[model samples]
Target: MLSVQPVSEAGFAAMAEEWRMCLEASDANPLFMSWPWLYSWWETWSQVLGMELVLLGVFDQRGELVGIGPFCRRVLVTPGGVRVARLYMIGNAWRLAPTVRTEYCAIIARRGSEQAVTAALVPALEQLKWDEMISTDVPVDQLESLKVGRFYDQRGYRMIHRTEDVGIRINTTGRFDDWLAGLGKNTRLKAYNRRSYLKKQGELDFLDHEEGRDGDFFGRLNAFHMNRWGKPAFDREALRFHRLLLQRLHLCEGEPAMSLILYNEHCVSVLYDVVVRGCRYNLQAGYEEDFDPKVSLGYLHLGHAIEAAFSDGATSAYDLLAGNGKNQFYKSHFHGEAVHFSTFQVVRSPLLKALYRIQAASPLFMARGLSRRVGL
Candidate 1:
């Protein structure tokens, strides 16, 4: 028989090795699902938000760990302005906020045991008293394997699915020349011209920094990021969360990488990335605002980083992760495939279900206004 147990923060800390092993065995694992990233995120934000850790650990009859669900309990205001308790995958509550985001969330179940694990998890989840459950950025097949739709239908819970933003992934396995050739002629020429212009302006230097070696880089990076957006990108809590993530990566030997573009010894642009299992996830980036606007330092730095990744043979794909639909412009330049993401909501309350239906039927702008008001 399979058994499920809720693991608190302390319990989770003690089961680091077990969790990591389960992650390794799971087919749906991604950097966001890594023990280091989720643990650090829990440490940084859970208490601040007054949320309770509700991580679930599943074990088989032989007492072997089979799956893990990194979940948390929080209060969410529904579209009708009713506040209710809800459960969500860790880091998912920040989905609408302009903060550090995690994508590709799913139950970390051993490759062939996903169905069984989901069957067990569905019952375990039902035992908890929550108004709704929201999970975002889940892969389509993974969710289907979970059979959440069928499970919810049987239990009379309303399951709603919405198409989220698409995730952009750049395949870097091909030869560098071939990769460049794949980009349209206009984009290729623009990249070349940008690099040439930057090179002529000053001595161009590209530097890579590991986790522990990034000294004052985060501060400068955040400043540049805020300046570019004309507003702050990360709050104090988010900064702390990012710092803890760096430390966690270092401890786990995750080999987090930060690429810097320097012009005459002055940092002009930077790209923070995590490379694991030949997949490079672009976490964050920023560039000096005072640089020559015509040179396009940001684009030049990204091109340099992609080239470096190909040269080092350290990456198979560069994932831009989920973001606003506007990123299609720059991401399209890379000629990458767009992986669509969706959010699934399971509602147990009739009132909430009615509210969701009404919101869904409303005009786009009205629904958006209500969403903002509800803090979605």
Candidate 2:
């Protein structure tokens, strides 16, 4: 028999070793979903943010842990009353290649018992008395390749939301020359001229920093980032969180990782990133107002960053994250694929609907409007 148990403090403590083992056994990369920050975020959200944490344990007949499902509980209030709902927190997770992480592999069961385990776990989760349940960071074939959405459909949950597809770009197995050869003549010429102009001016250089060893770099990085991004659409807390992320990289005391500040004598433009497992992440970039808009300094910065990644022997170069119309159109210029993702919602009652509305409408709790309202 398989049983589902709520994740308790003692439970996570006991299962910590098992979790690590399963992750390695399953061949999951640490950067994707096994970062220490995942645990940190879970703890912070559950403790500081008051979100309820539930870790469903799927055990085999032998009573050992087979699978773990981590979710957060959110309350939805409506005219009728308040109802308990489980939130996937997908958008809020802020991860690259989220679903590709192996930890999300659903129902880790012994060979013959896979279907049986899922069959039992479905009703088990559905019966938890919550008005609705959401599973984010889910695999494409969530229910043993049966697609859990179908299972949810059999029970009564309907899919309500979806987002545009996202994508990741790679350029490792070949040389930069090869990549250039692969592009159209016009694109190749444009990229070559752009890079050549920047290099010839001798203003283009990359400032390097390590996690703990580069305190000065971080200081300048903070000032550069703040002076560039501070007054934009982001809120104070959100911006603080972004800086804390950089600080973690600068302060984590690990391998000799690198954060690059691509700049010229005239202006700073982009931040190129390399993380655990030879992954290169590109930031949106900031440039001095005078030198930024006319020359497309940010795009040039990316061209330089990609060149640097190739020189540094990185396996892949990701374009930071996703973008909207103009931004998305710009990304298409790189000739990469975009991934489409959707959100599934099962509104148990009016209360749940109302809660979702508030979350959807006022991400950051309407801090954007609040800031403008107070003229801050």
Candidate 3:
């Protein structure tokens, strides 16, 4: 038999080791799902957003921790002025949606215990006062499984599953040169021309910073990203969250995983990455827009990062994480496999179900509304 219990922030902190053990025991765990990342996110963003942490723990009869559902509770006021109590992943907040923007989220469980853990999670979640439970970036099959769907049906909850975004990933097992050779002739020509043009400017250097070594990189990354986006990549609190994340990763002896391109001692581009298990997640990046219009420094930096990944034996996949409308062109150039992510929204209230139905019927309008609500 298994039992579910709600864990407070303090309790969650105390169970760090057990949480890590559960994460390691699970298969297909990503860097975003790691203990250090979520915990640091909670510590940094929860208070600022006034979110109530609802971390759930599942234990076996022997009192051994079996699974963890890192979640939080917040209130969402829809465009129709409906106030709905919602439960979301820890890194998510109502105002920011995905406050920390971690991908591949799910209940962390032992390799063979996913079904049981997910089954138990449904009833536990139903008992909460939240009108809706929103889980984003979960595996497709996991959301489609009978265990989850059936459990939601038994609890009188309407389950709405939709593909949120397509993630881009590249298998880095092959040689970097071979991978480059597979690109279109135009791509190859552009890459060569860009590199040749940049080489004439000055000495070029590629640097990798590990944990405990990323001093001003984060600030520089933020500035560069702001320059590109015309706004901060993450707000002040989110920035602090990333700093704490680096510290926590350092303490755990995990890889900080950042890459930068320096031209004549000046940083031209930076790639913020995270390496976990065997996969490397390209979380964020930015480049100097004014460097040289003719030379695509951003493309050059990405090429170098891919080469570095191959050289370092990070032989697993290189994930571009979630794709957005603005980045599709750049992501398309990589020729990576597109893996789709799904979100499961379980709503117990009939009114909320109707709202979801209406939202689904007109996704474009809802997207624009959401953009306005969140100031996106």
Q: Please list the C-alpha lDDT of all candidates, in the order they appear.
A: 0.76, 0.48, 0.73
Q: Is candidate 1 or candidate 3 better by TM-score?
A: 1
Worst 10 residues of 1 by lDDT: 322-331
lDDT of 2 by residue, 153-189 (tens): 5545544443324444655445877776776665555
Best by TM-score: 1
Clashing pairs in 3: none
* lDDT tens digits by residue: candidate 3, 1-376: 7899999778978877888777788863556777788888888877667689889899999988888878898876766577778888876563454476766777788888887887777678767888877777775655543225466665577887644777778888887788888877666555544677667878877888543654677777779878888886677777888878777774333666788778888788888886766677777888898887677766677777776677777446787777663544567667678877777666777777765666667679786785466332
Q: Model 2, which residues run further than 4 Å from truth? A: 1-3, 10-17, 27-32, 59-65, 78-84, 89-120, 135-147, 184-192, 211-258, 262-267, 272-274, 292-294, 308-320, 325-328, 348-376
The top-ranked prediction according to lDDT is 1
Scanning candidate 3 in windows of ten residues, the lowest lDDT window is 140-149
- After TM-score superposition, the amount by which residue 77's alpha carbon in candidate 3 deviates from its true location, in angstroms, is 5.0
Cα lDDT of model 1 by residue, 178-265, tens digit: 8888888767765554777767777887898644765677777878878888754567878788778877774444767788877888
What ranking emerges by lDDT with the best candidate at the front? 1, 3, 2
**Per-candidate total of colliding backbone pairs:** 0, 5, 0
Backbone clash pairs for candidate 2 read 165-339, 165-340, 166-339, 211-250, 212-250
